[model samples]
Target chain A: MSFDVNQLFDVNQLFAEICEEDNLFAFEGTITSEEINTILENVEARMAELQIDLKHRKKIYNITVECIQNLYHHSDMVPEPLVEKLGKNYGQFVLRRPGNGYFITVGNFVLNEKIKFLSEKIDKLNSLSSDELKEMYKFILNYQKLSSKGGGGLGLIDIVRKSEHKLMYRFYPYNDDYCFYRLDIVI
Target chain B: MDTLSIEGTAKTPTVRFDASKGLIELKGRSIPENSIEFYKPLVEWLESYAKEAKSQSTVNIQLEYFNTSSSKCILDIFKRLEAIHKNGSEVAINWFYDEDDEDMLEAGQDYESIIRVPFRMMEVAAG
Candidate 1:
């Protein structure tokens, strides 16, 4: 099956919807390592203007780094077909403040074949309590080899632990070849 | 051998590994996209430092924030130090976190649990 490039995930439409609410910053396009640095700088500047305490601000910033870098690392795993259409490392992220806590939503494309593993990973992370997650993080840190793409399989676990919230995720079927993976983290 | 000094950037940390004083200080953020690449020299330097045999080695890590990838590389460094400490070099790791930053403190404690080297959790005033 095939899907229109725009139909994969409408970046502009997503931002428009989020902006109408309480988005502090939003970006949708190719995310390079350099771009990640720029995005983090903007996030830090934006967070500085808020009334958040030091701990919360660091939590939000650390989570933001993991979220965006997750998108960046997963870019290589996207099927060649999707990479051609979306460009390598194409991803989007929105930082919003709705009610009391801040919301960070990061999205990227994943090959269909990898969906099961990704889903199971997130589900397992969401199932664990805070203490369990902490133990898992330490275990991975001590044991796991850092992937060539620069992930220790600790991003999702760290996000869940630091946020102290269950990770919210969805895998939207873009086509038979790829699925849009979105992670919504509350901080 | 000689001292290893690398300036910090927007995404990487400032690394200073001095062999003479047996002082290794890693300050600033450590969120480089390619953490393995960024930390390779420091790890190699530590490997060399291990052989030279200073009776005491002190490592001060005061990172404002580090990504998960960097976290792993940081652990790699600790593992090397653990080996050094096991070999009878007095290795002391002082992990500095801003006051009230429980996550950073916990991160230190986690490493302390994993590695045999003694770790001192230092709380500093938030800047």
Candidate 2:
């Protein structure tokens, strides 16, 4: 089945649907440099409206950027013929105002085989204390050689450590070959 | 000896390293898309600064959050500073963390414990 690159993702509609009032200003869209910038700006503006202080603002901004970049770099979606021709992957990000903090959700397609490894890693990270997480991060950073993207399980650890909150995750079956994984970090 | 200043972005930190003044400061968040590309020049500047460094040198790091890649880069910087300190020069590293940020404080301690240099971890009020 041939899918047109531009037709594969409706970024605007996705954003609108996810940003509804019921979602508490949550938004979802494709992963692009421009989109990333917009998300940062919007989150900052929302933080201002919510009277979030500058320090927490910095933390939220940093964590959000890291999560978005992770999706952009590691999301399981390989370029389809049309996407490759257009030079982009179809990714989504969602943000919502939850409790005393904001929750950022990111979703992307990935290979079926990767889900098990990712789930295991997330489970392990979720179970570790802050101290254990730091030790784990150090161990990974020291022993793990640099990959092409410089990731060696430390990014996820950093995300969990910085958030200081539990990670919420869900997996949706897309097809036999690909599944969509959604991860949320509250800051 | 020269100074290098790069503005911080949403995914990166501000870098100010003045070789002549022997003052290096890194602040803000760092999760750069291309960690190596962003840090290579800073590493190069430190390499040059280590040789031309006259007088006591002080490097201050005030970071709120950094990804794993930046963590490695931070370690690299500390190693360079340690080398300079070993070459019969004065070097002091002041690592500042938010008062409520125990994770950062512990991270600073981790770095301090690993590198053989005069390192001070300070807890400052969050801004």
Candidate 3:
């Protein structure tokens, strides 16, 4: 799983390029608990400054919380090859106003082996109707054990539920052993 | 027993639990990164309070937003209240939501459906 960071394009550069259209904020690096708090505060302040309605602000804020927490957990699963250069829990996120609604895009490096599992999870969530998703959320909340990181496997489901939109994602292969995972959430 | 009063933070909620009057109040947002860690003391308080339970218990939950992990911890809190109710004390759970937040209302309903304890969904104007 050893590969030079030069083989793939710089993650920060990629984020900057894609987020040029009305990007509110784009951040790349380690995402720790402290960072999550700061990010949430910033998002809230920015949305409030725009005078977004309470309902929409709450929705966007909740979605952002789940997205950043997901990144905090999954981003740590970085491939061994890039660990030195990227560091643990390396992640990036962009929040922007692309059009009528807000969009949140989060990216992280992950092992290739996890790509299938993550893809299937999102696809299954996208396939279900709102009611079904609610049921699934309740089922997991009642039965699943929270991981050491305090994740109950309900982050993605909560994101889809709040957004009321299909979950969109992409996995760009960095090498045979690792892939840069990007998830797009519309709110 | 000692009363539990914790001021809310950016990531946690304000908690006010009084065993003498059997009153519990949880207000503000609950989006802690580690919900269990933040809620363990409160949960432990509930367990001990359940033993010498009062005749009537009133619980008020007012939350702006809670992450998935907090949601699970919330359910655990409800279950503990349900036990107290099943053991012969009267327990009333008031779940307050913003007037326009259907999701919060539904979340309260979902918890009511699962836990045997009675719940009153109160709609409040968004502040």
Q: What share of the true interface contacts does each candidate keep?
A: 0.95, 0.37, 0.74
Worst 10 residues of 3 chain B by lDDT: B102-111
Residue lDDT tens for model 3, A1-187: 2334565656667787768978887778889989998888889898889998887888888988888888887788677766787788899888888878888899998878987798889999999999999999889988898889899998999899989999788887777777888888888
CAPRI accuracy category, model 2: acceptable
Across B46-117, the per-residue lDDT of candidate 2 in tens digits comes to 899878886799889999777767788788888888899999889999999888676678778878767899
TM-scores, chain B, all models: 0.97, 0.96, 0.98
RMSD after CA superposition, every candidate: 3.2, 5.1, 3.0
**Against the true two-chain complex, what DockQ does each candidate achieve?**
0.85, 0.45, 0.81
> Lowest summed-lDDT stretch of 10 residues in model 1 chain A?
A1-10
* Each candidate structure's count of clashing pairs: 0, 0, 0
* Maximum-DockQ candidate: 1
lDDT of 3 at A14: 74
Q: Estimate how well candidate 2 is docked, as a DockQ score.
A: 0.45
What is the fnat of model 2 with respect to the true interface contacts? 0.37
Q: Write the per-residue lDDT of candidate 1 for residues B1-127, one digit (tens) a residue.
A: 9899999998888989998998999999998877999999989998988888589999999999999999989998998898889999899999999999999999999889998888999999876
Q: Model 3 misses residue B50 by how many Å?
A: 1.1
What is the two-chain DockQ of model 1? 0.85
Q: How large is the i-RMS for each model, in angstroms?
A: 0.8, 2.6, 0.8
lDDT for residue B71 in candidate 2, whole number 0-100: 81
Encode model 2's per-residue lDDT on A1-187: one tens digit a residue.
Answer: 1223343353345446555623443444456767766777787788788787665666676677677777767753743632553235666666676556677777777787888898888988899998898788777766676567755557788778778897877666545666567787887
